[model samples]
Target chain A: MKKFMNTAETMVAESVDGFVRAHADFVVFGTDRQCVRRRHLTPGKVAVISGGGAGHEPMHIGFVGQGMLDAACVGHVFTSPTPGQIIGAIEEADNGAGCLLIVKNYDGDIMNFEMAMEMAAGRHAVEMVIVSDDIETARIGEGRGRRGVAGTLIVEKIVGAAAEQGRPLAELKLLGDGLNGRIRSMGVALTGVTVPHTQRSTFTLGATEIEMGVGIHGEPGHSRQPFSTADDIVRYLCETISRDIDVQPGTKALLFINGLGGTPPAELYLAFNAARRFMEERSIPVERSLVGTYVTSLDMQGLSATLALLTKEEMTLWDAPVATGALRW
Target chain B: MKKFMNTAETMVAESVDGFVRAHADFVVFGTDRQCVRRRHLTPGKVAVISGGGAGHEPMHIGFVGQGMLDAACVGHVFTSPTPGQIIGAIEEADNGAGCLLIVKNYDGDIMNFEMAMEMAAGRHAVEMVIVSDDIETARIGEGRGRRGVAGTLIVEKIVGAAAEQGRPLAELKLLGDGLNGRIRSMGVALTGVTVPHTQRSTFTLGATEIEMGVGIHGEPGHSRQPFSTADDIVRYLCETISRDIDVQPGTKALLFINGLGGTPPAELYLAFNAARRFMEERSIPVERSLVGTYVTSLDMQGLSATLALLTKEEMTLWDAPVATGALRW
Candidate 1:
């Protein structure tokens, strides 16, 4: 797979440089090039922070703007950001109201973000919320957790709104954890992602094959099956989440149909339509929904379906206007 | 390039299905499936409409919403919509204030839209504005016209704002044409798009080669040249447009850096940063700018740079708020 990047090593730095240039109005470079913080930090507000690997272009970087993350500690593609980088964001984004670190449930992310929090513990009040909303590895009886996927956006937006209202750190953490618990996601990859410098996809799916319950980084999924229609894929993904999370009838949830980079908006919509119809048939009340490329893994041809059962308060917070670079409403 | 679509033949229909499903709140299907109109109508406001081939996901359809186009007649991928389909949109979008047809410079589009205008001659007042802002084929002295590319978005946004303010058909057309005249675009093709159903890319380039000055629909550009760094590409594109369009030093212009699908936001920003640097080096004032995947060619991996010299009124209109699915700000 060919790309327009100059080299794999400089892809992240150049991307961050470009991000600042594009959104110079609302964002600025942090202490390091790997970190970016809001241009005008709101005083006395709980600072929200989120980050992970780099392949997911809009996940942490695009979400770092008004009404969302105060800062994002950008790591290399499919590689975790270092503790020093995370510390830079924490130090820059803190405005006297404690900082909240939103971490996806990846081993490297958890370990790195935790180490960074420990480093910043004495300097400032810091908290962490690990989002393991993916149901692909569900083991509810044994108390095993799911991995995080596109559902991070939901936590980001809701927690962001609450933080904007000056919610305490503990409350925001509780809200974030509760939201994460209620959310379940499952994704299918039609193709593998090619890292920048490598010019090679991490994995490969045959012309007529698909991988269900795949991770954002092309992690092995529950099963590999022959390719199916978009409608079928959406239904299967929604079914997996709905069944694993035990979504009850009459439950009002928000449907997040996310594109995995290579997938276009039209395909996402088609998948969303299928998901909506599936939910409707099952008598699940869809309170709200979003369809776009929120969380991506480079240019992988795939889609993830995340259903978050929102409380009344959560719904209100989710509806709050957000002015981020990737998502605005 | 694997896709999630069921078939190429039904790609347009399925995409429209997904579009309507995702945007059921603000838009609805026009009489025909290819045509889409806003759910709410002001009854006496001038109706703005635009369309072309369907592969440009957000161009015509994603733009159908409040503060933008009232209706869009979607054609097949890289193919023109029938005059009958366009006429349906014209009739449905008219709120008794008249309708404006924004046709790109493609011959099929021009002919179809013209025929549609003739079909709606007596029933409603109709006019058309042809956008030939692509400077890739600049031949001013030969009386040759350029092709329309991403610059159409500027025309649509500006004209849509004026129409929202109850501007008449003739005035809206004139404003649209004038804006189109001031805009110039040139795109490069890094990878050809694979239209749905066929499952084959339109064209291919060697690993180290690129098609410069390409049109939106896979049309060949100035020449195929060796690929270069992002900065070099940006400088070359800006220089080509500058040399051909004769952009005077110190002139204020709006820079629109568009991604032709597949390209990430960070990459678009990277390209934008390079573009801004090029303009700065030449002492050209960038009054305003927009960077996004507003206009795309399916899943093509390339970008287009468009610079529009604006008037004071045009600047105001360009800054006006628009609430479209793909371009809301």
Candidate 2:
């Protein structure tokens, strides 16, 4: 449970500074103590922005660029980026085309981004899209809300492409809604990630156990299940996502087998293989597939499967060009 | 170390299958214990393909798409993909426009991809570019070669864009070479990651030690030093990269603050900020900056920084639209 840092308090600020310095092409702004933005504003393009706790790398920030998000509000490690920060990002990315806030469906994120959206609407035309693609059925009853996991990236990519294509704010919102309906994600955590500030693993499981459907911020998943083969894990995840969104044969789908930080590419590929088999067995057609760590949870050892049901149009949008730190195409 | 797998041997293959199932829009091959291709391959564009060990998630596979890699070969977990796999990828992606193989400068990756290149050259014209961006000064004298780390992403993006633009294979090779020369990377690992098959951390580090210039496979770095502040770490990494290339103020550079698997984004941003400040103090002009888990070690708690020195042409290529699983732009 050790970390490489001077003090817990300075960790977030220090990280932000280093990020801006390394990415000078981005017009970065914000106090050394708070959230920041990239300066390269897409003049007429509808700006896309997102932010949340800091554990998910390449997420809110890595996504900023042409054909993606224009700005990302930074939050503390595992904490929501403040409303003020979101407001600043909105203002900075805002041009005549307005802005889109892609907030993950976490309680804190939803609350903060919602408040920021309200505040910004007073001065600018600000629109928002909440991604709630986590398909853990256990959370359906608590009303805690379906946690936004790896599927957030798909939402960003799809909606970001639409925004880049000059879709109006209202139309973009509809597109976001449409994409969300077509997407679902489920995850399994083998071990917990130690948050640097806490210097302790965020959650714990037995060496023989896997926490099915865990959220990114070290939240316990629906249940702790006996560890199984990569194939079994894929079955569990695919079944969950498919049940949530009826993925039928001949349906064009985008599969994302995402690493939850610490899982190796090999393990992710294994999980992905099982998922592909599951689809093939059912004669379902996989139009596009991505396997790797897109959205991550620090170094937690786990993987999440995100299914984006694609129409021909969505597939075309997925093919649109993009330039971002994490995603280039 | 808990893991989500029934057997160690099947991990990589399963993950690859799941990846294709999840994104069916992209044409996928190799679900049958072999190399794979994306179906979205343009008919006339020169295909870009890259691959290596399985631990480096998103490096080879996540980068496969429209403007990036046309296909990716996934090796066994933590092992290089076989020559047959590489050849398969090349053949699947080849479309009259010769294919470019972007191989990272690893002994295994180099040897395998080289063999594949030779095999493919007999039938389809194949060109290769070796990326050696690791700025680990320690490896300079080894004569073995500098291990390609996160900087491979830059090579892939630039070259992928060039290929997408229908550049000749020779021109793409030169572009890849130019990017390799301009890009430099160095990393520090807080903790080692365990390869699932091995069931042990790839390497060992102390509770209060950071391994500087660690490789993606969890190889031991140049030295284990006392854990320091993010600023100090950034300085060490940046100075190492800067020494390898002349990065002056007003020179636009693409800075990448990449996570080595387990490092949190918060910490990455802190490191990014420090790097930015250091460069600002020195008047180094950073044109574009990226912070995220691009090329990663399975949940290794560390970060790496890559500086892609941008010329006008390189910058244009860098800004080109790319479509992939992990990277959008």
lDDT: worst 10-residue window of model 1 chain A: A137-146
Q: Candidate 1: where is the Cα deviation over 4 Å?
A: A137-145, A248-251, B137-144, B248-251
Model 1 clash pairs are: B8-B196, B8-B197
Task: Report the lDDT of model 2 for residue A123.
Answer: 83
Instruction: TM-score each candidate.
Output: 0.94, 0.78
Report the error of model 2 at residue A210, Å: 2.1
Q: Ignoring the other chain, what TM-score does chain B have in each prediction?
A: 0.95, 0.94
Query: Considering every candidate listed, which one attains the maximal TM-score?
Result: 1
The count of residue-pair clashes in candidate 2 stands at: 70
Candidate 1 C-alpha error for residue B49, in Å: 0.6
lDDT of 2 by residue, A175-246 (tens): 887788778998888887777766888678887888888888887788998887777888988988877887
**What are the per-residue Cα lDDT tens digits for candidate 2 across B217-321?**
778888889887767888998888887897644348777888776665556666777777777777677667777677888768888888878778778887887
- i-RMS values of the candidates, in order? 1.9, 3.4
